[model samples]
Target: MAKGKVAFVAHCLLNQNAKVAEFARLPGVVSPIIGKLREKDFIIEQLPCPEILAMGLTRWWTTRDIYDNPGYRRHCRNLAKFTADLIEDYYRRGFEIILVGLDGSPSSGVRYTGSSDPIWGGRPQATVDQYKIVPGKGIWIEELEKELQSRGIPFPRATGIPMDSQDFDMDKAVKEFEEFLGESSGVQG
Candidate 1:
């Protein structure tokens, strides 16, 4: 069987300082899956929407930051709508696997909405003409990466991950990831 091609859809304006909070918002966005499908070749793309991430970061920022950026309020509204559209576009691409982590944006009842809580995440909403961000099992990124590495597939470098969230060493997050993707997987445990 041909190996699976996973395309990770990440938020734009990625910064390590905020990655921890971002990961906390959606814990298993990539890590767990990376650990599992070790043989799978993957292409992870940041959502490529700077306005959306900026808007979200605005909300997460301290009151001072919010106060500093008066346009922050408007950014949030426009960003919410932009995100919905962007997500729909990605979904329409018909990726075999699509992971959307709405880290900072809230549901406006327009685009697809996933839970802030990782445990109750993965909600698909109707937006695009045909595409739908359907709900599915939260992927085990670490295990997936481990499995992929064993297969010698190249894993995209993770730019922004939380520092203290996952069990694996934070500094080795990418290194371990590289190793994980080299491992092989057969038994579906």
Candidate 2:
């Protein structure tokens, strides 16, 4: 029998190549976090990268406001629906599931997302300095929750690694993730 435990992580968490230029912190997967999940015997499921799906790998660093358009929202909702179907299948099989998002991401942040000045746009020489961390779920996360809720599926608790902050602390993020993972080890829907 399978372990029946899984973690749904943002695509960039598993493949930094999916990130925008100059935004990738690791050469590949975030090994520390992935290692912890493996140590806990949880199967890792990488969620599709919304940004990459909508804009491609050559996309620029952007904020929530930049991506808060109808087309993008529709794209995210479609992806969420597809993902929720798999989640529901897992739930039906009595698998325990959790979500790991990238904090400060426009598409996958759980508790914190990116925002920017009203006049901000992707310029030829644009930098991340215009971006601001705001309190809210990212576009993709919000849509995922909605889709799951619509299907009467119990949404799993989610935690995010602070990848956007200038002062990100890996140890603290990992500790928090561990605590989140350890809580309510019982099987979930």
Q: Residue 72 of model 1: what lDDT?
A: 45
lDDT by residue (tens digit), candidate 2, 44-138: 89999999888898887787887888899999999998899988888888888888999998889999998876546745555567678889989
lDDT of 1 at 160: 29
Number of the top-ranking candidate, with TM-score as the measure:
2
Return model 2's CA RMSD, one decimal.
Answer: 2.1
- State TM-scores per candidate: 0.31, 0.92
Clash count of each predicted structure: 38, 0
> What C-alpha lDDT values do all the predictions have?
0.34, 0.86
Regions of candidate 1 where Cα sits further than 4 Å from its true position:
1-39, 48-74, 100-161, 164-168, 171-189
Residue range 1-189, candidate 1, lDDT tens digits: 313344444442233234423333333344453434444565454443333256444333121212223364444435434443443343345433434333222221112222232222134432222222223211222222334455443333222222222232444645644463455531121
